[model samples]
Target chain A: MKKLIMIFSLGILFLLSACAGENSASGNSSQSTGNKNSEAGTKDGKQVVTFWHSMGGAGQETLNSIVEDFNNSQDKVQVNAEYQGTYDESLTKFNAVAGTDSAPTMIQTFEIGTMSMINSGNIIPIQEFVDKDGYDMSGLEGNITNYYSLDGKFYSMPFNSSTPVMYYNKDAFKKAGLDPEKAPETFEEVEEASKAIVKSNPNMKGFALQAYGWLWEQLLANQGALLLNNDNGRTDTPTKIGWTEKEGKSIFEWVKRMVDDGTFANYGTNGDNMVAGFLAGDVAMFLQSSASARDVIDNAPFEVGIAFLPYPEDQERQGVVIGGASLWMIDGKPKEESKAAWEFMKYLQTPEVQAKWHVGTGYFAVNPAAYEEDVVKEAWAEKPQLQVTVQQLQSTKSSYATQGALMDMLPQGRKIMETALETVYNGGEVDQAYKTAVQQFNDAIEQANKARKK
Target chain B: MSMNPTLETNETYMYQFERVKKSARMKSFIKGMLFLFPSILLFSVFVFYPMFKTIYLSFYLTDAKGSTTVFVGLENYLNMFTNPIFLQSIKNTFLFVFYTVPPTVLISLFLAILANENLRGIGLFRTIYSSTIGISVAAASVFWLYLFNPTMGLLNKFLEAFGGEPVGWLTDPAWALLSVSVTTIWMNIGFTFLILLGGLQSIDRSLYESAEVEGSGYFYKLRRITIPMLSPTLFFVITVSMINSFQTFGQIDILTQGGPANETSLIVYSIYREAFVNYQFGSASAQAVVLFILILVMTVIQFKLGERRVHYQ
Candidate 1:
């Protein structure tokens, strides 16, 4: 028994030391890796700026090239970009690293996270940096900046801005005997065209819509409708969602009628499925982010056309809200490092870099001057589908509703909206679904407010 | 050198011996601890610490950064219980378990029996039966996602050929949970089959031979000899399958995203959404604690029930 006890205790001690060694070794390795980059930058008295972003695939490649160009443009700073998964995941990680020494100097947060990041009090408003440096802000697009600003002051720099657009199979339209070049500009026209397409091919769905909340939000904005109270959550905290209003009901009822008529297929909440449907010729047309234009063009078997997101016949188009992410400089970092990050941000907004980004990734160039760049003009001349997104942004009406909703619980609100949409699509009563979703949103906002107070 | 050396006293000798024994024991104890230290430390750091932290955080309200700002004892739990979504998630989790466990055990047991035969090419059959075990949850879910696609999926195509309508395998709430459960059942069969096969191989051939000699039919022999002997493996498979079904997330995330009116929203998915999406770490931790307790109670019940019915022989 004594011998057994001795063995057990010895075993425990061995485990303890092993764990300690492992932990320290990991710590050393991470520290060494971090030190290597900063060391290179520090040797030349250059500030090192660490940037965390959520771009992946080709977008990541383009972003890396842009960062490389910025690093080589001058000797004052070195920028290192890191891919940190999806937008939601990146924001979650950013929040987790807040107050920690390991926080990145800069982060790219999705547009929906704007209010949350602002409320966190962990970021330096981009407007402050712009004012301090007296940077040329006139070159940036007014509409893109409108989404990122609060009361005419920008909080973050718009990086990869996108708006929802209609993607259609040109061949499908031709087969249905509809004018291939003429795209539907109103919801009623889209419904009528869908019926013609379905009548042409029984096996094909006339239209498919992704059940994403962003799409619904964009629809509301196009109708000049608010998503939340307090003027789209711009002035103060929103206590209730605006989805119970007439515009919201009309959107739901339109979708339900489409589905009921077998003209529209609901692909659930994944936007990729709708994109896939359009590419595979299973659907005549679909609504998706302009950012997806590259993927669709690369994969679609037929000619694809892009058009503006449809609005109701009676409601004037108020433009769609941006769908992508923006760059926010983290607070509490060294002032020089923050300035270095700001310089990189400025580089990203230059006409040449923005043109490269727009041409490469199919995202809207935040800088309006980028459209005049040779690379951008040539790419648009070759693929005019890219020009449609630019035109949509330029033509959008500047209004509080069009500026987009600002809510700390926007992610949760979007999730609830998607759930309510799914409920309606599944044959549940629209009023019941909207009521339950709104109540949940109100509860979430209340809880968030209470937590913020604490 | 030893000429005038006195003999040691008995008490002194015994005392010296006791000291030497004590020292040796102490050295061995240190050695044992040294051997076990790494495992104990790892478990304490990765498992126990996180568990204790979860319990502690369950009582506090957390902010966007997941920092605890205020403590409201049991408020998180109370709110979770009152939330209809949470209650629905609990029900859905239970439904997933009920839909999965029995079918998994029965089908795998049947497959194991078929594969346990001493025939040529049995290895190939066993390999075929157990191939799904090699596929990770993410990979299997992707495969199922394609198979569940409403328009172009193979499953719907097969159904359409049988004169049935193309059902929305993933879209309709009525069929979403069942669809995900089907995928889970398919994934679990490989593991359960392997366990049951091992159990079947271990059962003595004499028992079955005796039953055969008594002119028992195949069903009779299976029920009387094979089943009773396979009770232990069945118990293990059921317990593991139950636990796995309760924690199902990847498939639900990929295939349905806990959607179609939250029909497939299990407890683990709810906890994830609460923590990551809503940044409600306190409520998420509370949900986690509840899940932990539930799993513990379930495991205890399984063990207690198995103790009575599981035949060691």
Candidate 2:
């Protein structure tokens, strides 16, 4: 009888858990409906805009406060900002609920996700709102507008923007007898500096490049090389990679030379660790997103100097593509809710809010006029490193390569490049790694194109 | 006429007996089904449906939303076999299982034996031995991630203090899998230890007492009596550990993310990357099917070969 009772209880427990699992899955799918009902039933007359973002840490804090300010500034719309993990995770969640009523009022997606977002048919083009409101998008930063716009049409509102910059230890440069004021502007110069730094202090490695695909893209752009065929996939669907062997192999061979000299620090795909290593003085220089400028500048014990992204000596500097996310208005939302979201997005673009955003986070102000704001001027005065990021963006040549590639398969391409970069970092043959990466990248592009047909 | 009537009555009596037996059998079968209904419902909803869906999806191409896009029979499976990264992941997963399973079982068994002693503070030692069961995979992996950090991590600092060069635990392709395996073994020990300790304690004391009376030594009794008695628990632990290691995802995600030239990208992580990250559900489903078959075959072989050795006392 006891054994029978035990089995019976275990069965009950299993049944309950199974039911719970089903309930939760349904709950996720029905979240928007639940939210809508609650908002409608609320006593307040204000419309609710469910805003989803992928900001974390300092960025999240600043974004939340900005939302609160926007809510308090007016009673017509109450924007609820929800953090939805990293860009990859958030995009995955958005994909799951894309066409369903469970989707949020609006979402912030990374730049590489632009093509996929447009193709998903789950987002309303921001151009409709721009035309209706007669919003002057030209007032936004030119480089940012270039990246967010395609054929003079805005599909998404440009929010936070950043570029790749070389962060170096000025103290280490001085100690190595290199001029602290003048930074390395070419790959060959960086290599020479790295060797000097390592020779001066064997304890500190010369350079660290976190095996990140976005950085690879930036490096390619700086060398005037396109990442995809047909004008970086802007003219037509890309069939294969665009960069020449010399353009692609220059970056790899540079890193390989440094590695052979034992001056390269391999942090292998973990940006946090590379930054940590930099702060801990294990490395003298590294390349990373300018969005991390504030964190790196504040944490480093030594004098930090920010410089332009280095290009190959054989190629001219073409500058960097915008490396950040944009605000997308989700489709299928109520007209009132979308209008409220649009209002919040407009509020975010004003010089005051953009200034606050730029000062609070290392991300560039989408509105160029934000630089005139006192807060931004004061912040830039204190940390001139922030000014370099804006300068880099402003100086970026208006080319299709610098405008970045448009493809649904960029995220997959990134992983392929990251793996190839890691292979090179771990002492694999560069030619072999590059060949495999290119093959996989082209295959991914083809597969993505095929998958979209049905 | 009287003889005919008696024969008819006898036939009716036998027919009634047969009908009664059939009705009783039907009633018992209904009762058994009623008892099994809950489990059947759960399994159908969770397991059978997904298994069938995965198999069906393995024959098609899917879009980002996971809806079937094209009917390409066996294309997804063939592509997986041809893909070098997928082949590498398979090799890494099997290597991970080999690296993690035996050591986890053996180390836990050793700890269980030691903690099973009747010392004054044996409870404390047992608690310490089994404490890792409380630490979640994410939290434990994060902890080990810091310990394995090349620059400021405690492990590297210790190595440097010993006058040895720092090693990239997760960065070097040669060491990344070994590093991940070490973390898995550490995380798996607590549960295995507790289970083995329970098995050790529940063994008949009389068997040990009789062995002691026969003037047998510790190793002799452990080999002849204890091992045979504990074989069932050992077998259970081994099987669970093997399955758990094969399905390892959290630690790999947190620690390595299948990095260092895809050396640490095991089967499950690869599936997640394919389905979620790359948004290719068809190929991911095919990989899942392969993994399912692999685990099923291995488990079947283990049960077939291992059950003969287990003494289920």
Q: What TM-score, to 2 decimals, does candidate 2 have?
A: 0.95
Write candidate 1's Cα lDDT for A298-411 as tens digits.
Answer: 788899999999998988998988779999988887788888899899889898999999888889899988888999889987888989998998889988788899887888
What are the lDDT scores of the predictions, listed in order? 0.83, 0.88
- Best prediction by TM-score: 2
Model 1: CAPRI class: acceptable
In angstroms, give how far residue A301 of model 2 lies from its true place. 1.3
Instruction: Compare the candidates by lDDT and give the number of the best one.
Output: 2
Locate the minimum summed-lDDT window of 10 residues in model 2 chain A: A15-24
Per-residue alpha-carbon lDDT of candidate 2 for residues B1-313, written as tens digits (9 for 90 to 100): 2568878899999999999999999999899999999978878878668778888988888877788998889989999999999999999999999999999999999999899889998899999999999999889999999999987899999999999999999999989999999999999999999989998999999999998999999999889987898888887778778877777888998998999889999988898899888999899889988887787688778877987887765
Q: What is the lDDT of residue A282 in candidate 1?
A: 76
How far does residue B274 in candidate 2 sit from its true spot (Å)?
A: 0.1
Backbone clashes in model 2, listed as residue pairs? none
For model 2 the local lDDT of residue B127 reads 91
Candidate 2, overall lDDT?
Answer: 0.88
